[model samples]
Target: MATNLLKLNNIKTELMVVASPSQSKEVGDVLLNVDGCTIRPSQEVRNLGVILDCNLSLQAHISSTTKSAFFHLTNICRLRPSLSDPVAETLIHAFITSHLDYCNGVLYGLPNKALDRLQRVQNSATRILTNTKRWQHITPTLKHLHWLPVKSRITYKILLLTYKSLHTLAPQYLSDLIQQHSQPRSLRSSDKNQLVTPRSRLRTFGDRAFCVAAPTLWNSLPLHIRQAPTLETQAQMEHDPPGSLTLQLQGMRLSTSNKSVEGYTYNSFTLQLEGLNVSQESTYPVFLFILFSYLFIIVANLGLAVLVFVDKSLHQPMYLLFCNLSANDILGNSIMLPRLLIDMLRLPSERLISYYECVVQAFTSHMFGTTSHTVLMIMAFDRYVAICNPLRYAVIMTNRMLITLTVSAWGVPLVLVGILLGLTIRLNRCRTLMKSPYCDNAALFNLSCESVFINNIYGLTFTVVLFTASIGSMVLTYTKITVVCLTSKNKSLNSKALKTCSTHLVVYLIMLFSGMAIITLHRFPQYSDSRKLASVLYHIIPSSLNPIIYGLQSKEIQNFLSKLFKSNKVLASK
Candidate 1:
């Protein structure tokens, strides 16, 4: 091994002991040899052109790197009079910017004086590019060049690394630095699955560590920006020409000549909610009718949820699942109706929403709706067991079983919708106007200027997984239940089985076909009043019908509500 090491090319070795303040005077050098080469001892060593000192202040490294970068930049500056803008930028990026960005995250949490040296190198480069005086402010120059400040560049580097580590197929060592924060309560749904940074005690270690700087920078970004899948797109989303992120960071917008930023368009994103086909004269009556209907849906679902919550006798797994369905109904309607109402009653100009906001609304609406489908499938499975496997039903539907099924019903849909939303945000939405009244994945995806094969393929994948897994499960479960009922010796048992399963089938058909119809319309678009009407019905029918389906079909709920209402009436008369 020693003879083999001697044959290696361009390799040099050094030793530097990192001793604490108390051991500063006690340590002595020890000699070592590798391939008959004596190890040289020094206070600092340069690896990958970054300096590391024994004290670990990082000050010496910063000073050395800045000096070297500035020396190259000054030589490039001498040719600036002869070079064009693009050529000059290429030279600066190759020589100067590359050095500053390399291992910048290591300098994180260092004192301001250490950063000042690097900042001075950057400022000099900007001055050479713009031919501006040294005394002039550097903010505008940085913005024009689309360069983040030295501190911001460090943060950007760390955050980009963290994003890749968490979302992409990263190596195990880098991936282990951050963990998803799993808390019972989150500030917002968007914040629920944030990556947590581990704490450290050493100031330099903590400051430059990936864990400390990454989470702070990641959390500081808006949810939409953080949701961006790539560092390139994240930077693109953050760079709005008129009021950019850099301006927001400074707390004041800088005044500069109106120059266009390369590779960015100043166009604003706007989406209009689709309106009802009714004429202006009849719009008010339709609006009023829709308003009353929305209120009734909310009141019915809320009342059912409360009944399930308060009535101890009705606290069975089936009723608890009904409560879950009703809650989802309320959520789905809440996402769609308020915006629909606002668009119907207001002028056309008032109906516009930004691209990111549209993505969020579309994501949430689908999440709740998909969750409802999953819960319905679970209910079907529940009844199938009660009828087909009567003896083991108790064991199969235990409290632990019920909790696991319920959590999966909600959890699976949330993750699926989040994946779809993340992919949708990456698309460049060039078209501002949408014909649909409400935003959805299909509608917004169609508005993108680029080819949408990935989006199309994923949409089909979602539909297949949802229908084949969920609906197929329901069909198989019900078919088995039918076979068992016909084979049963007891006629009364068969009658009881039919009654229980029929209600669930009816509810399932209503939700399944409504969802299928919406997807059909979304896939094949034609300008018709029916498209808008279908969207309205898709949002309305499931929510409004949930209470009626469960309440009328449920004998126990009817008995409890009848006695409770009568008792309330008697008290009111007094």
Candidate 2:
């Protein structure tokens, strides 16, 4: 073979010492220098790590005549450990090649920084697993188990290694140095132009005329030249913020969005855009109090249901409605809290609900809500007649009439809610934006771009009529019951009536005034958050307090629960 020689600046070397024995003498000179780097040998892989076997030893030769470098690798993994000399030599060659373009990359870190990590990972026949927390469903990844079922451990190690390598390498590159790597890295248009412009490639190194005798890189990149202030500042201004990723076209970005941002910034007009910035990591403290309210209601209601169902002696008409209300309280929460739990797990962007789904959800929620209100009214009337007009109570509220009123109580809300659902759907929901976690009628109407005159009118009219009719019935029934009780000749009936009606009166008024205030606020365009929160007190506080009210009012319910708990304790002791 023909012979040739190269000279590299500062570090002279005869690479023929590392060449193959059979190879003819040849030399290709080149300089290889880095502006910045933090390269090192990777950590030792634990357990039975990679076992590589090979016949050929790694041999690198610089061809001066043809201007190329050749590497013959043999058992190279065992010798060099990481990124074998052959690979490093090839990388050096590519870094030096002038007829290359790497113009679509945007990075700011050192080259070959990740190459130092390859050997730390080793191939093993057996796999590994990890452990995690109580709340976590899948096992966690904090510590690895040395052995695992191959099928269960389906993640591929090689792909993981490559990704980690990229991560380690990416940060060291700036947007300008467009060096063509062994496997191509993308460069931006500016970087591509910079690469094509050969004069920008090198700066003086070591204050000497450079010479190299290897086919690999021989670049003279000075420390200050690596970060030219004028060039870097311009790069920062163009790409760092208000500049387009690609070349700016006549002074505009690519999309139709009025959002002008190269990065996430700006606080101006933000509350109008996002409404709230809730962190996923934090739980609202108010919800914990709400949880307590739910827990108390559940424990109380379950106790009451058990008493009515198991203790046959306690099963009567008045007690039956109490049980029904308790059960309804349970059902109401079943519909609400799970939704909040799910919403907590997701990011805000994923919390978006389709318009149709929102309308249906709100419809169902209010249907149950209004049913609870109407049920309280019926309970009021039942206690009213029983206490004041005891002799005529059975005849007046016959089973047929009770059934009819109950049916109407359930039916009216269902029908009104259906109408609300149909009316809300008439508006095109393409532009709809929900302001609350779950849908609310007021929020829906507010989101409509089209005139919401009919929607608001119907909602206001229905809310008024329903609240007045229910509240009026309670007032008239209780007042009549009161007059009758005070004037009754029977001393026993008067005393019983006063005690019974007093509790019902307080509970009814608590529910009524709160419900009316809530409906009243909806008529206003905006209400304070505390005012809105006041309505939840009507629903949540009453449901929680009902058991306490009834258990205190009725001696029978208290005794039943006390006896049942004692029996369970006896059974447990045995």
Candidate 3:
């Protein structure tokens, strides 16, 4: 049947039998005949670059790995004299370390004698990279290089795979093998993010299966690590702390200390901002310009919001969305500019921010930015309804609908940003220096030492979703509005619709272009200064200009301001 299935699938098969040492005697000389081909069982077979023996002891695999690693190490050593340090390190990692780490997860629960063989290969590579002599100890050197010993590396691999499986990021086969611990009732351990460790009947072979071993190691991790929202955060929380290497080398079981894991906790961070990079003579003038710009952004956005709230005529749906946009602008700039202004007055070295403050700044800034985009999208929809369905505009865009849209615009971004910040704030940072003048999600993310694949995925997903939804909605609405304006016979209505939309279109275009420039420039290291300037402008320019643009374009606001000024003049004359 197996041969028939393989034939049906067009697969050519070579089969082998792997038995434990005790069963090998009973299963001696097993042979089979299929399709006129005689196949005899072998003592050892190479599968997927790993040598599997009949006893399943893995000794053959270790010997093969060490032999291959030493071969490359010897060649690297021969060329080491002429190679630079960085090049030599890269070569060692590419050749020796990769071989050692590849598929090391399967090496879990291996005897010390077997693991030591792989460890020796790692020691040799590190020694060769650092030019350390045979007489010297390799422990400190390995610690300095931040290399985890073979056993610990195996554990890390297993735990990482387990995390991926739990998060649905792994293959379905792997995911099916693992399950999260659950109970019918609330318990103290319910929230611990524990995995269900499957029972294995055999201690030697069955226990080493991924299903059994993965959960065993995963459940042993710190609670904080297991609860981490992303892989990078988990890695940072589980990173090797001081003395972990020594424990591994001493043949002791690896255990993480809560204190050591949290030892790198920072109360504050110093920002290394690259402002306009002006000379000392130009610093104050530039500072003054930025200061006044901030002042204008605050006053203009707040005043516009206040005017919309106080005036009954401007309480329409479009104006209400505009007011929300204004509030978001004020919020976005206020999160960044006040600190920026303060930092300008202080010495560069004195520019410090508490950890929580930085997190809050990043959270609020991104939240408000997202809110701005959503508000603009809502505004576009508002204009669409008012222009295309003028007779039913009041019915469709009622006060209840407007309030709901407004609340969602703010609430949805808050939830998204909150999740983002929750993940980001828990990351263990390896560095505190930020090159830009402000705290942002990208800057905060770059400070972590671990791989941020999950964070990047989530952040990119959020950005794509926001951009797609907002841009798609605006495009669809505006297209309908354009069609209405062009096809309509009433010239007066067309002009009014066009005038109202022109202001929003201008604002949206400015925001879209500035945001795109910042996002694009961030990918190139050479344009770092330009990127920083663009980031600063992304916050301030829209806020500072939105009020001026709306005031000049909207007749309702213009007439309201004119009336107030004329009334003040009449009161003064009386």
Of the candidates shown, which would achieve the greatest lDDT relative to the real structure? 3
- Ranked by lDDT, the better of candidates 1 and 2 is 1
Write model 2 residue lDDT over 355-444, tens digit each, in one string.
555665577567756777777778887887687666888798786866776787678778887887678666542133345545656656
Candidate 1, residues 429-516, lDDT tens digits: the string is: 5345566777888777765555789988997899798989877988799889888987788898798777778888888888888877
- For model 3, the run of ten residues with the poorest summed lDDT: 258-267
Clash count, one per candidate: 3, 37, 0
Which residue pairs overlap in candidate 1's backbone?
A: 273-437, 274-436, 274-437
Which of 2 and 3 is ahead in lDDT?
A: 3
Q: Which candidate ranks first by TM-score, i.e. highest?
A: 3
Distance from true location, Cα of 391 in model 2, Å? 1.7
Please give the ranking of all candidate structures by TM-score, highest first, separated by commas. Answer: 3, 1, 2
TM-score: the better of candidates 2 and 3: 3
Q: Cα RMSD for candidate 1?
A: 21.2
TM-score of each: 0.54, 0.49, 0.56
